[model samples]
Target: TQRYAITIKRSRSDINDEIKNMTLGCNRSGYYRNRLNLTENSRHRQTSSKLLNCLFKLFASRCNNTWSFEVRNSEHNYQPSKDMSVNRMAAAGSCPHQILSTIHLNDLSLMAISKTIYNELYSIRQERLDSRTPIQALLNELQGSDFEFEYQ
Candidate 1:
């Protein structure tokens, strides 16, 4: 079931902001992130970041639009867990480290999306402490390379 609420928080906020506060964004590009909940934060941050990268690639390849999103001020701390979200997020290219990488490509779409922003909570920064984020795998794959990506 979907639920909604309106609360006065001393400071003003809109529905979008309210939704952001209620849960970690389905995607990382948003005003604020739910920082306290490590389980949800990593779960969302990793999956959402990978998903953003996926979307960026999908759009860049099919269309010529330049997609970009700002980076969050803070970073995520990765800890090993037995949680189901971990495996799902891993498949989606969500890693704590290796947030960004030099693709060494001149394509406008990739170039625009790779450009970094400051003082924001937009997309995740790539820090590849882990083996490979989904972005790297996707980027390296040949066009039309088929692979299975899933969650749960």
Candidate 2:
């Protein structure tokens, strides 16, 4: 029962080249903060975080048409959650054809595939956000214009 979250991602590629690297850490890898400020009063109840500051991590790299995985700080600070298993392959299997078409046949590692899919998805989301929201679109337009405004 191991679950990991991407802690870092790096990619360097031009139209003709691609390289990717990522670090995955135990899902519970951060300090749990019950409150942002002790003095703040909230109508909603404060929720507890599952973070245990776990140190376990896996580094995955793809370079020179090769893929490598390395582990560091290999101890988990908490017990694995029974119902928290994730099916990474299933998720990857559902990647849209547009994203799948950008991947090279040699770059078949789960990390590689996921990186490509996520990058495309992120760009699509950003484009949608920039284009669909009237306020955001207006602000972007204003930023490029000589128009001036004041706020308090």
Candidate 3:
């Protein structure tokens, strides 16, 4: 029920196939259009190039050990939609990977969450007045992140 992780060292190398395979990135593509029509397999095939590039930058930044996330056995528990039944089915299964990992032992959650964040950040950067976390708005708060992180 649980998945495992692989570690990588960042000496500024190109991203390998398996790690690239693990990132979910469909909605960021042109076809998705905020629709839930595509199946999970189709989703994984087109990972977010933007986020992958972001990860590439992250990988190149520091000469230290970092997490290289991938998820296997995820077709059983990964659904990217607003459907409750699909999510219930997904929850019944075991998901052992971290958020940084491929949202499953696949890339569903990682891709979806990253896509959402990427969109939100895009809206913020564009100075959208209605954006929940606008850049100018964050400049006033100056607080911690909504998600928790450990200082390693």
Q: What are the candidates' C-alpha RMSDs? A: 19.2, 16.6, 18.5
By lDDT, is 2 or 3 better?
A: 2
Worst lDDT window (10 residues) for model 1?
53-62
lDDT of candidate 1 over 1-152, digit per residue (tens): 22111122223234554322221222222233546656754564453232221111111111123333232222322221111222233446654222223222222222112222121112223343135667665655534468655433
Question: Judged by lDDT against the true structure, how good is candidate 1?
Answer: 0.30
Model 1 CA deviation exceeding 4 Å by range:
1-64, 78-152
Q: Which candidate model has the greater lDDT, 1 or 3?
A: 3
Tell me the whole-model lDDT of each prediction, alpha carbons only.
Answer: 0.30, 0.57, 0.36
Instruction: Please write out the lDDT profile of model 3 over residues 69-123, one tens digit for every residue.
Output: 4432223222333221222332455232232243334544444444443443454
Best-fitting candidate, measured by lDDT? 2
Which candidate, 2 or 3, has the higher TM-score?
A: 2
Q: Give the TM-score of candidate 2.
A: 0.41
For every model in order, what is the number of clashing pairs? 10, 0, 4
Clashing pairs in 1: 93-134, 97-127, 97-128, 98-126, 98-127, 98-128, 99-125, 99-126, 99-127, 100-126
Every model's TM-score: 0.13, 0.41, 0.18
Q: Model 1, residue 144: what's the lDDT?
A: 44
Model 2 lDDT per residue over 6-108, tens place? 4653345545765566677766687856554653365265544556678888887887778899987788766543311123322455455434444434343
Q: What is the lDDT of residue 46 in candidate 2?
A: 53
